[model samples]
Target: MTSTATTVPAAPGAPAATAASAATGASVAPSARPAPVPLADLVDAGLEVPVLGGRTVRHVNLDLAASAPALTAVAAHVGAVLPYYASVHRGTGYASQASTALLEDARVAVAGRVGARLDDLVVFTRNTTDALNLLASAVPGETVVLDIEHHANLLPWQRRGRRVVVAGPTFGATLDALAAELARRPAALLSVTGASNLTGEVLPLAELADLAHAHGARLAVDAAQLLPHRPVDLAASGIDYLAFSGHKAYAPFGAGALVGRADWLDAAPPHLAGGGAVESVTVDAAEWKTGPERHEAGTPNLIGAVALARALAELERIGEDARRAHEDALAARLHDGLAAQPGVRVLRGFDDLEDRLGIATLELERGSVGLVAAALAAEHGISVRAGRFCAHPFFDRLATRANGLRVSLGAGSSADDVDRFLDALAGLIADGPAFAYDRTPAGWCPRTDDRPRPSFA
Candidate 1:
């Protein structure tokens, strides 16, 4: 199913378009037509996951916090465009030109999805890790990242000897505390997540942004959790930069982006050294390209960009607000249901994990969150996640067991999945490995069993 919206338009001085440009290039595009239809119905109607043994027709996949499944529309769109793919901007050939146009157009498509500025340069990188790492190279101040950030956002700063500060446990208090800290420090940069990886907390974004600006600091949001399920108005949110991964945003390709503040990125040295990033390379010093090209070194992943753009379009058509409300209700169901059980502690210092959708990470007890995750998958067909996720410092602050179980959801998730998962968890902790998970194909599938599949790997 193709999307009806074509929302992006040409800038003030853009040239008129023809059939050829429309076929494969960026031009002043029109707005997307309203899509009364949503992909969720199609996903719900027929979806399948293969296994080595007797395959279950309807398996619960609740690992969306880590990575979400693709919309069928997105998959079909990518499949159709795969054959036309070419080495973008590598040559003067027709295919190369076509690919380059589509690649740039993907930027416009992404901008429409997020309501970003018309001229905002969107650089497509491999994933959230690469995108943020690339952006970090440009930041000119002592960086402030919360202990709540994923390792992807944190490690890059530490490796560079940049000053790092871990924020308070609660989101509201964290910002209040940071205001005073930033006052004492030089003009600094703050990096935070829109929705946290664990606990599914949506940070105090508007309030915190205000505080950051007050302290002469700007905030960069890791929207890896927020972008897919909800609307992220970067301009209104008062964030300086916005970062997110596509795999978490209904497109499971190696693609992600960091958008905003072109100057900081323009001033810093390029993250990767390569051909496309340079404007003109003599045998001596190179004349660097301007705009996003300055940062986006090497041959770009044109197909991944196309796929990500389409995925964002699909989400926009379905209406971000509606998706958030539906998924939020589902997350609440799981939270409340789990809280009723004995020995189960649902940890949330703020309101309902900050109005997040499709993610609910909690601790069953102190010692074996990993074990509980395994048991849930083995005995039943439920697929949830465990371990500290990637937010080591956040988990450390809350004093959770180093590894905790994280049960998440997606656009494809059902109430039945959560219900079955809750039932499975109740049984698993008591009985221990009901199906002998170490021995079965379905039981020991990619992410579950007697042990967890290595997360970092």
Candidate 2:
């Protein structure tokens, strides 16, 4: 998916794009609309099409906002560290010391990537969801969340018995709305997502951070979507704390982190208390170790953290500006192409904003979103997400509250992938209403080779 805008005006005297709608309540036929080139087209051209069924089946993976495929450099970095794997900051063995150094190095690497202070501790957990949970356990007092936040960033507060104030889609006026919300409720922390998990529209992080600080509240961002595509300057952005999953960042590891000030994290009990977290345990009396170790208990997923660090380092090496440009260009291409379609309503930057990520979630005419999604995956071999995308509140304001289809891309994507998705989508829309072929498992269709293929035929 790319940012889309139609350059070609209605062919001379054909009809204004809205003229048909004004005359009749129904939209114009999508088939009559011109096709726009998508980013999938560019990406597919460069990638090696895997051979399946005696023919090359080029995969159009548009789910990168959920998780990107690992880079070659990141894989190599992980392979190098595998031989020296050992417990960090615990064992007296040489491997242990080396591992300890590497773990700290990983912290520094992650800190640098996000523009945090070097001394800041990056406590590793299971994934972004886990990282946010860790923060939830650490922070005390009432939490304020936005309507657009993913559940990982919202539900944790509920579990902690903290009062959570859910705000509406501020849209262009998020900061003002947040400031007013904070004034009404004196908050200790504000948990927010850096971008919408579903729409790929960026939240105003810097502005939000500033607003949170003015009201004497600390802000923590779930950068699950931001880390893979944009440069997350935690310090510069004024975000006191940040969390993102390694797997979602293209590491595909169990490791994730809650990185920020040590005071709040240190004052709170260990999220998962055990071995490395304690200095001395005597049933009743226990002394905890200093720094990130106080939180990371058990053996720790050493390999996972190393891989995640490598992934971030690779992103930094490639340069954030360059990568964003590549993805933004592709997204713009797709957005323009799709926006021209009569009934296609893109769930991103429509009226006010111009810039956005490569990811796009949309609704099509005359079809169930689930059916359309399944058809794209099965018939076209193009993977796109459909439904609420873990964002129910965001959908509540959308024209289609039941569900909306998502199309997201990432660093690994090219133009061909975008094109394939658009091409597949065109066919799916033209087919009219989408109906589940049978009572197969959800997200399943008569497929070639995906996890547990179901027969759509």
lDDT of 1 by residue, 317-358 (tens): 888677866676676667766654434665553542356655
Index of the highest-lDDT prediction:
2
Off by over 4 Å in 1: 1-57, 349-354, 437-457
Best-fitting candidate, measured by TM-score? Answer: 2
TM-scores of the models, in the given order? 0.82, 0.84
Clashes of each: 9, 30
Superposed on all Cα atoms, the candidates' RMSDs to the truth, in angstroms, are 15.6, 7.3
TM-score of 1: 0.82
Give Cα-based local distance difference scores for all models: 0.68, 0.70
Model 2 weakest 10-residue run by lDDT: 3-12
